[model samples]
Target: MTPEQILPSPQRRQTYWHTALALAVLAAVVWLARRHWPMVETGAVRLAVADQGWLLVAGVATVATWPCSAFAQQGAVPDRLPPGRLVAAQFAASAANHVLPAGLGAGVVTLRFLMRCGIPFAGAATAIAVKGTAGGIVRGALIAMLVAVCPGVLLVPSLDARYLVAVCVAAVGALALLAGPLSDRCRRALTALRAYLGAVHARPVRAAALWGGSLAFVALHCVALVAVTRAVDLPLPPARVALLHLAASTVAALLPTPGGLGSLDVALALALTAAGAPAVAAASAVLGYRLLTVWLPLIPGLVVLGVLVRRGSL
Candidate 1:
């Protein structure tokens, strides 16, 4: 048989390997969870999520974060994708992220959505990177501030050390952001981001409103987390909890795992324990929080994505 007749195409090979890797990783996580399931406190998990107020707050935060994040992502694409279309694309991508293993399936789906909306591949790629990376920068700054304001937070052991690392990283990262060519690179990566902000720059009143709205959106999620921790009555102090959140989220963002699922859980558990909370309680709270914050929005996002697609808005 000729080579062409005997061999699979390169695209098929790529797809096969990617699927295999994803399956392997999923199987490993399942096995690990099953093996260690006994260590988790099922009862605690149940109790933590029962607080209606906290759950409501978490939902609000998750939704609010989307728009602020979308704003951050705005200018990254060229005019190929309109703002409304990009929003639909983001929602669709987020929906895919929850169902797809390894977390990148959603990103790929989103990239395709952008392309469909007329964004160049290069611009889409850069925008995704910036949109994701900017959150880390914000978290790192928050952690550094915490370290200075509440040095006692360092006593949390696992978290304190991470806070220190974030402080250093933030300093270096900020310097890089400010560096001339690097700043320009980031600007190019977020073309829409620049356009949106610049268009409003002259109107200080409007600019202030945008900044305030964005800040409120980001803060709501953090507040929700804090509220959940309190609702569960976890032993950790509020300051320490905030620090842990900053560190865990930053680390999770860097993690290769989809949505930082397993990694975020482990980090939260450790941070809680280190801050002197009972292991089972911490596990339960973290699990409950993830369900509310991550899995909950996922359902609606999927539906929205479908709507967008059907309407040809995505």
Candidate 2:
């Protein structure tokens, strides 16, 4: 049969676009990795795991992030998911997040999973939105608490007010342009989101799970960072280290890079240095942190992703 007959037009177009986007994102990741390979290599070689026990704890914390994420995700929705499958989907989502920028990969996977569980599209989107909003609030609260506890620990240089103003103006302009076209859909989505949020808040159990899971997720990540610092014998206080990580990650999340690969490594290393860690120690900690959180689980995560996709579970 002819090519047009073999595959329908819209589906074919979507497939091509997806393939192109994937290739572009992959290329960007590879380029960034290659550019930053020296630091990672040096850090890996220089790392001295002082205590195997601490390293094990770090690994456990890293593994724990998946369940934390799944719990938060389930808490966003009213329906209960099959526990094992929910965790597995989250594991797979982590791998996917490495391939796409700005957590889009994870969002897509979670959206699919929610749909498979019988949620309508609007409801599923609302759940994801609620989870993300709760996470942001928790992260901000943690940062604020840490900063208050350790005043002047995070000394990020001030940016020009004009630059900030310009960025804000541009963003507002873009949003204004899009608003006219998307107002109807935006209103519908917002209404649905408000309703879903109200429902979640009405249920104390789900509300607690949502906030608790969000806090746990960020805490575990900090704990993993602490473990890496100890693994390398970096002389930074645990609280300070956690604060620095939170600040750096919050900044890096704006970059839209896959898993915050290149941007996060540099930002985190710099943040550590600013927070009083020596250059070598900071680099080592960053490298070790990424190794445990991203590189190590990557292969197995992808394997799980493949299994899920093959079974039509993702």
lDDT of each: 0.66, 0.86
lDDT of 1 at 133: 50
Encode model 1's per-residue lDDT on 1-314: one tens digit a residue. Answer: 76557657995676567566655555766786787687565735556456677667766766666665455555333243465766666666767776664557667766767666666776567556644555555666677887787676655436677889999999998897688767777777467666644654556544444444445545666676776776676776667787777777666554455666676777777777877887777777787678766787777888888887787664
List candidate 1 stretches off by more than 4 Å.
Answer: 1-32, 35-41, 75-86, 100-103, 152-218
Which candidate has the top score in lDDT?
Answer: 2
Error of 1 at 205 (Å): 9.9
Q: Each prediction's TM-score against the native?
A: 0.67, 0.82
CA lDDT, candidate 1, residue 114? 66
lDDT accuracy of residue 108 in candidate 2: 92
- Listed per model in order, the count of residue pairs whose N, CA or C atoms clash below 3 Å is 3, 0
Clash-forming residue pairs, model 1: 75-191, 75-192, 75-193
Q: Find the candidate with the highest TM-score and give its number.
A: 2
> For residue 29, what is the lDDT in candidate 2?
58
